[model samples]
Target: MTAITGTVYDSSGQPVEGVNIQWSSNEDPPVSSHERGSRTIDDGSYRLVLHRGSWDVHGTKDGTGTEVETVVLGADDAVVDLHFP
Candidate 1:
């Protein structure tokens, strides 16, 4: 598994709390049930352990809009930040 970490931020560059973070595998013949989710902590920081593969990660809040990023994980971990406008 690969460890993914990052912080969620608003348009003004402030950390956002309680943002929902979800991800799903994007590999060919996609793995079944290869999806997971988490929420940001008080510091707008979040972490997820995902299998090595291509995946689409999404972040969203009640009214702050949603952000999506595509990540490819191999042997090394990755950091992906999300921004909402």
Candidate 2:
């Protein structure tokens, strides 16, 4: 398993609170790949745990903006920090 984390901010560079994050990985195949995610805390920080592999990560905020990243996870837990400007 791998551990990914990061902080969220707005265009003004202020910490955003109560942001929504979508985290998912290849579940079956092209036929079906479940999309799972979580929301950030009041401090604008969040974390997700997934299996070691290549997965796509996306962070979204309502009425704000969204950030997407293609991550290649390794056997050891990895930390994916994101800075949305």
Q: Which pairs of residues collide in candidate 2?
A: 23-36, 23-37
Compose the digit string of candidate 1's lDDT tens values, residues 25-75: 788887533323689999999999888988888787885555778899999
Residues 2-84, candidate 2: write the lDDT tens digits: 77777777776766776776655543552223344667788788787777677666666655555767676776766654556
Per-prediction TM-score to the true structure, in the order listed: 0.88, 0.72
Which regions of candidate 2 fall more than 4 Å away from where they truly are?
Answer: 26-36, 83-85
Off by over 4 Å in 1: 32-36
**Candidates' lDDT values, in order?**
0.84, 0.66
